[model samples]
Target: MTELSNIPHALKGLNSVVVHPDFKFPDADVVLSVTGRCLYEKQLLVDTDIRSNHSESGGASTSDDDEDFHSQTSRDRRKEREEKNNPEKPSQATLFKVHKSVLRRASEFFADMFSIPQPSNQDTIDGLPIIYMHDDPIDIHNFINHIYNSDVLHYLPLRQSTFNMMSSIIRLSRKYLLLRLAPAAMFRIRSDWPTTLEEWDKNDLQVVAITRWNAQVRDGSQDGGSRLGPEDLLVEPCRVIRFARQENILEILPAAFYHLSRLSSLNDPHRPRSCIEGRKRAHGYWMGGGRYATRSVLTPADWDTLMIGKAEIRAWFVNFRQYGWQSIHATNCGADDPSSCVLSSQGGWKNYWDEVIGVQTRKILAQDGLDVMEVLQVLRHVVLYDENLCSGCRVQAGKIVGCARTEFWDCLPDFFRLKRPNPWGGIWMEGEPVDCFEQSI
Candidate 1:
């Protein structure tokens, strides 16, 4: 257990027993002394160029230069001065007075910890046993808040802050063996990042709608300029990918990678989208509209996986264009000559690719389309609705497209070189170990 004196080191002269405002249980029997750095301060390599040794607990240790350290020290001193003047600020909290029963009920770690006989010389604060932890104070607060109020797990409205909170809960829950909370958190994450083709379509449609809306507003075609921007509406994929990799959340990796791959590879031509765009700036990429830019924090290995997976998706589309439709056998044609209809269907497919598909692909993605889901939807819609195409060819096209979509989704894990865990796409059942990510990642 960390001494109470050590609390001042992190809190900067703040009282050792500064209780969390929301977690100040009246009948509390334990004090959780959260002594970890703020979550954002624990950077996992801000720049891809700066390499550092990673700790076993998945934290990277960067060797900050003298100037960086000096700047950090100056900021710390400024914060300390501010806190000294306003000591009751919520950010000054480093202690949580929580119930042991709640902890034991929610976490196996706490249950085991309490089950053990306490030392005769155990330290106590306010006549309660003190349990020191090296987890972020905000994470501890979020974890306990979730325990007290289950509503913290609701990941609706998909904001970066929501994701960050959920991530903190997931990380701490997994650390302390909160079996139910951990899996539930994972479920929320998977829900946001589509794992199935149908879900992907829904997400893509939302993005498409937002992109069009933003475009219209920008061009003075739409009236609602006060509406939320794309950045406010959409969650960035690269950040999700980073958290997933850090926590070994393998199931969400395929969808995350796929989404990231869809963004334009070129850098933002306009001014920096964010303040974090200078010395330690992240790489920038954008989707179609250009109203919002995503700062990507991908490592070399992640980039390699993304590039390789994207290439595989593009190759699948190219191969499907040439050979996939050829195998479609048109049956029960309403045409006078069924053979002629089949021949015309093949010609229609060629013309569709040449005129519609190829042009759209180039215009949107600036290359051959890497988004298989989008292309598949377009192809199916044209085949089904075209007045000229026979019903027989339409049905065959639907089946072929459906099968191709499924095939592509199935290949996502392999395409990204990710090991898919059993019982993916939902909350894990009781006693089903949730640490199913491949050990080697």
Candidate 2:
């Protein structure tokens, strides 16, 4: 057992716990410790049907008696094998002891497996039948962890390992056909993505996860500034978008593309969309190894779609600037006078607006692939709550931006070039998981 103090140091998760990657038993990195018991461990690796390691209950008998007993046992075993329709049980079988009732209740696969009439050679330990699994042991451990602890989702802290763990849970849940467990896994995965501007603002962990998924970010690298660069943005969101597309989960794409475009510089044609533009700022490694490298995971079609969406969003900005509403007299409207507020209502507001508000908003909203939360911050900071600007002009500007929002929301699907519009026809909201079994997990 890991000592309580050592757990903080030993809070290990997969560096890249991918979809059942090449694995072996007794690996130091992959382990599960819970409820004072550990599964899928070296000590627990046992061949249930074999008793080579077992000790006799009593002293050894005479050679003649032992020979007679062994011959009789062999004859009984042969008879048992010949009598049943079940395939010959393995002379040696790996064991995982779990509650039969839990398996029966949680999965139809288990229900069916256990439904088979017991073989005479079936093995047991600690009052539980030995249920052998052919899956990667790590996957089995993760899935069983969820079954044992329904509140396990809440226990997951915000960290780089979080997504990888959840991915493992989801894969196993789907494979075993754990219908109830599957949605919960999907829900947590879906929740990692922020749907609204508010959710985006509050979630730094998601950003860290997005950043860490592709490139490893070290501790203390997160400085509260414009430290996030395009290199940080490209790999993770694109992979996620690809995942969503494969899974037929359209809801996750709009925000994903929006973030991707901002990061990829798709909105700004002047800025080159170069992959790995500079010598890597943060030392990191590629998770996808060998024939499929992480850099090439984003398919060509995905690249084209993201670029198109970026161009489309930038085009909207161009249209808005050209025809939506431009202030004619770029000056202050003293109570009664009329003045347009494109940059700002007052002359001073123009300088701050150009340098601070508009520029950052453009980068955050159009160029730098990120969420709108930062842009909203600029808006809140720029919009005057006092008697600095005309009430009528404020209303007009508000109405313009409001209308722009509606237009933007309506066209997000077209922005991302998705084949079919999301069912909500807008940003995905966190709620009941999509009910279609085909697309559920």
Candidate 3:
């Protein structure tokens, strides 16, 4: 619902994370990848040299290069280059020294593996067991990173690469059934692709997502959008759809569809990434890398909702002029309410066409995309801040806007031609359906 509340004592929160309370996950036992040379092996020899001289004074347990999560981030490429140039760097693979006890607490998968009846026959580098994985080495590394930095609110950096990392963590967390991890992973997911109106109010997350999105799509941005694909945040509603479906996160679909409709403005599937090069770069981006490609991620029913929902929202804006909403007006203007009684002089009855509420409403509708909640914000701000309206009438105006918002929400399913996820009495209908995709994953 909000950013995490943990503050570090170091830079404390920047590029760093707090350890779990039981943070005794010492020595990485999981050997993610074996290298040609012992990266750690070289560092140990240097540390030994430093410590022997100090032994004559007072010996100390010094910090090692391979300490805590082994910043293996970019070192793999560097390690490869070094091995190629100097073929005599002691041919050994990289090793991770991790704690089996900590892995057991975080992952039931590991717990089951450890519980299997066998001689503790696994290989080890430094007394710690080496567990090899068939998963992408990058993903495995990112998952282990979270285990080390699982501090609340201390999230990974908000870069495009981070989004890739997030995708990995979500899948891994769900697969491993990491009970302690679901909340943090899901919170990040919710911030980017919220399903509920309340979650959509997180402006900070929106700003970051949109900024990153704009950089990647129509024409690439100065943003590192090159690394981000259409399936990435710049334009991937399918990503959210698959993730929510996989995780049984049913609530994310509706709001995600809302964002998708707006996103469709930039993403014309027939358009190529080549069109937006150079000068066309600053222009709006279409996140749908391939229209058919993105649509394939959703079930037919979900696809119908998105298509109908988008058209219906645009239709709602057009029909506002002809909708005959006269019955919804309230005229019980309090005796002291000058604004209400005086509007008769300007016009017989107030409407969006009236000079008072004119143009702005149309301006919002005319904007490239229609985000219903955003429209409501514009409407509310106009009504609440109008100096022409009196206190009592302002209160009444707010009531009217509230009523209209409720009405809009209520009719959403009907507008979208959807029977499920309806706002029944302003609440989502329970057990609508999330099994649309019965994937083995």
Candidate 4:
């Protein structure tokens, strides 16, 4: 008989002792089998089988757990993708449109400030002018007076010089009014006032004012001197009132109130019967009562209208008079003048030498022509501001502020080519640069 210990534990666990027909157990009586050992081994085999069954059940649960983890990961990825595909909304800004009357008012206001002659007709572009205010060394009052005396009917020639002077003023004013009033744009012109006004209105501008003064002699002052004696200067005081619109009857309300307020404050027993006072006192009497009244009621709408009108006026003049005969002449002169011309057919070195040395020498030798200093001095009074900027850089530097450097630079290259100094230091130019000179600079 085989020892129970040597038999496999699982087979030993079978308690039934049956011998095969061909096999026999030797010494059945005398030789005894170890049943206890077989029983112990059999129990161990049964425990092992039970453990294997539990392991298989655990593996099935693990597979289900892996599937759940994979599903959660996919859900997270889908949520992330959805968020990326749709974004939040963005905010918007407000925009406004202006009326024409406002622009006309602004143009007129500027014109009044500079004492530029007012346009005589409703459709003519005559009252365009410039006002200079700032640290400009030039005397604005004197400059305006010179223009008045010179009999320069059209003002396009003054654009180059005036642009430099006026840019500073506009920049300063822009800074001052930025917080108080939002100005999206500004326009300036030296053309007929009526035409400018009409164009501005057509653009739905909000404000308008002319910076130049239209000169008008009092009815009796044809001979340069007043005919009446000092005591006999009893002249009827005159006041000019600008309406918002032809149909706007209420436009006069503010003007009337302003006039009444001034009248109440007057100390003179013979109070001037004028919205603006002192019309009867002197030959060159000037008053800006209308400005005080209008400025008090300035609004965003007013600014829009004013700016639109100015832009329209500028566009019109730029389109029509900018290339006119006078403009062409001035442009040509500026292009040819060694002092103003940036380029020449002779090359950069030759042009620089001629302008810096040759032309300067001639200027020193030339005798003084007219005492235009007086004229310059007088123009200072008429101009509200002045400034200068180089045509090379987009930003205008030097004592001027608030103007965008980029805008100034962009405007300069073309603007500088518009005017040229004569041999005597007078300005002239108005056309395109000569083709040969274009490549040399």
Top of the candidates by lDDT: 1
Q: Per-residue lDDT of 1-441 in model 3, one digit per residue for the tens?
A: 111232212223223221211112333344343333333221221111323343344532323332432454347557667768987644432333456766788788889987986466554433444454545444554565556546623444433345444666777876787777767777776666553445556643554566555444534546533433323334356666666677676555665566666654443443445655532322333333322225666888778777788877777655543332242454545546454554333443355335544455666666555766666666767877778666655566656555555456455545555444432334445445321111100
TM-scores of all candidate predictions against the true structure = 0.63, 0.53, 0.60, 0.15
The digit string of per-residue lDDT tens for model 4 on 42-72 reads 1111011222343465511223322332243
- 24-45 in candidate 1: lDDT tens per residue? 4556788888754422222211
The deviation in Å at residue 424 for candidate 3 is: 7.5
Residue 245 error, candidate 4, Å: 5.0
Error of 4 at 65 (Å): 99
Q: Against the hidden true structure, what lDDT does model 1 obtain?
A: 0.59
Judged by TM-score, which candidate is best? Answer: 1
Badly placed stretches (over 4 Å) of model 1 are 1-19, 25-29, 38-93, 114-129, 151-162, 190-195, 202-235, 265-296, 322-325, 330-334, 337-349, 359-362, 365-369, 419-441
Count of clashes, each model: 0, 3, 13, 84
Give per-residue CA lDDT, model 2, range 264-296, as digits (tens): 322221222244432122222222100011325
The C-alpha lDDT values of all candidates are: 0.59, 0.45, 0.50, 0.25
Question: For model 4, how big is the CA root-mean-square deviation?
Answer: 43.6
The TM-score between candidate 4 and the true structure equals 0.15
